[model samples]
Target: MQTKLRSRTITKPRSHHGKPAQSLVARRLPAKRPPTHPGEMLLEEFLKPLGISQSAFAVRLGISFPRLNEIIRGKRRVTPDTALRLAHVLGMSADFWLGLQQDWDLWHALRSKQAAAIARLEPLRHVS
Candidate 1:
């Protein structure tokens, strides 16, 4: 059976040190926004170093292979816990993961909001 995938939304905030707080995504601005999802980069980098398949990586991350696949495909959002776990497993800086996620969330949220706004404006265009 095909499972329904839900996009995850981050509500809480964290600190540079991984401390739980409010709006970490906001606190770390411009500089924190990465050029791309670090997880995707990390995943590729990690996979090369580990010499394992997606299933193996998923096992190491304590997530299902499909879920891991979703993350890689940009279909699923990465959570803080998952980011931390990745940092631990892949020997990457935890803050890097957090920054990537924060950046991804910010851009995705803004783009989505913009698209919705544009969509609303389409009907008005037809009426004009």
Candidate 2:
């Protein structure tokens, strides 16, 4: 008999913003939403604690210094591939990085001119 391996998904109980037991449906927006970039967390939480320099960490991740610098400066977004690299080196899951990027993007978008325009858009149909 052959054994079957299955993958499982684990959801975090708390968000980085310090909410506990965050529900999936009707996601709660933070009381005072501050768009925090992943780069800030990466620098303060990971790099600072690990004592890893930006240039050195870039070499460890097999990426260029300028690229890593941009990421650290919040000028660049962390893609899935970059998330994987970060996960490999930082001993964290790729989802963590992606989630950070997503949270920041959502918060930023909510305050953009495009969001105001989008608010004017009406729903196509009501299926309910």
Candidate 3:
């Protein structure tokens, strides 16, 4: 099973005020909804289509069925160890799984109520 990954170079457009426009990441984020959880991707893209039972896949991954189920249900984050195991079994790079998890995490973090305070933080100026 080959998954085609596409890479693109994004050009940042400038606003009329000469400031950089919203980033590609920002544009892709849904306004009122969280992005697709990585677990959903794993279930939809790999497990169901491949007809792999959770118990069997968990055995193959050398993990417990509950642990695998938690991941599939989005109740658990895909850690580095899980990513590595998934890569070894799925033939995809660990980075792919980790990246999806990161994106999901960052999107939620940015949308939280504290995000406004985070945005207000100023960078320290360097002493030349």
Candidate 4:
């Protein structure tokens, strides 16, 4: 009678071809939201620290009181010219105002782009 040999069993298996495995890390992308204008933030900071009335600040800034109020209320936008005027009256740098305006502009631009892209997508329809 011939003796039969049994194959050896391996406890730990390496790579298919015995090569080292590479490591990879996956990261989640940031979520997007409706962009906001920064005029509100700048106006809030200007008003909050001094505890001054909006009307008074507007007068001092040479801007219409109603317009200033609108800007504060987020109904009106902060234009570069308006920001410069505000900065001059508030003893802030023009650069600071410009930065805020720039941020607001970029945000609105992105928001518009997003809206356009969404408009191009197919709308959901209900089935009868």
Candidate 5:
């Protein structure tokens, strides 16, 4: 008599971040989608809802009006220190601001001309 074996499939659980892991093919060439800047989120979700003016919010955060304006316009990237300050004033986590900045920066950078140029560079070979 011979024993028969049954095949089984195992499924991976979704990530804690709420997004499902990309399939192998999807990972190679991710779909191109524009990411919303953290500044936009701040303006629409926070400032507008709270009826806060840019100047007033800037003063509350202890940052210059111009600096806050630049951020609101998505001209400048948020530094870790600035993230902490925003988080403190908004009663949000520093990681929340930092993560938004990071995601915004990375998406923009990846979609830039520099990223295309970098992709054309030859890869280094492994040393023996």
Candidate 6:
């Protein structure tokens, strides 16, 4: 999914040092689309391009074919163990795979009902 992000300046409360705090936040307000699942990315970008079958890749990764298939279908999450295996087999960093999964999971969580309640929460101020 393509998302067009625009930057907005946010001013935060001054710290003990009395310096004006400002940050440029690139908010994705227009597009609420969830991030691409790592499994889908793996299937499209790596498996298909490299002409590797799911079963063969699973064997190489030392995982069950069904587990890999579930991941490809977006029914399973890519755990740290799986991420490390993928990194070792595909020559990509484990962080790359885990980052994708984290993004996907966070996007969904932020849209959940629990997130609505969390959004109404106010941060506690320190009296230092």
Per-model CA lDDT versus the true structure:
0.65, 0.74, 0.78, 0.58, 0.71, 0.76
TM-score top scorer = 3
How many clashing pairs in candidate 5?
0
lDDT of 1 by residue, 4-117 (tens): 225534444333356553332433334444457755876676776778788988998899989888887777777888888888887877787877777777766644546445
Q: Model 4 segments beyond 4 Å from truth? A: 1-36, 113-128
Candidate 2 residue 36 C-alpha distance from true site, Å: 2.4
Per-residue lDDT tens digits of candidate 5, residues 1-128? 11222442323222335554322111111236656777888899999999999999999999999998898899987888889899999998989887777767766665677864655556678999
Q: What's the residue-level lDDT of 4 in candidate 1?
A: 24
**RMSD in Å for all candidates:** 14.4, 10.0, 6.7, 20.5, 10.8, 7.8
Candidate 2 lDDT, tens digit per residue, 5-84? 24423333343345543233232234377556888889998899999899999999999999888988999999999999
Query: Which of 4 and 5 is ahead in lDDT?
Result: 5
Estimate TM-scores for all models. Answer: 0.56, 0.73, 0.76, 0.54, 0.69, 0.75
Best by lDDT: 3
Tens digits of per-residue lDDT, candidate 4, 65-106, equal: 898888777777777778788767867777766665565555
Model 2's alpha-carbon lDDT is 0.74
Model 3 misplaced regions, further than 4 Å: 1-32
Instruction: Name the runs in model 1 displaced over 4 angstroms.
Output: 1-34, 114-128
- Model 6 clashing-pair count: 0
Query: What's the CA RMSD of model 5 in angstroms?
Result: 10.8
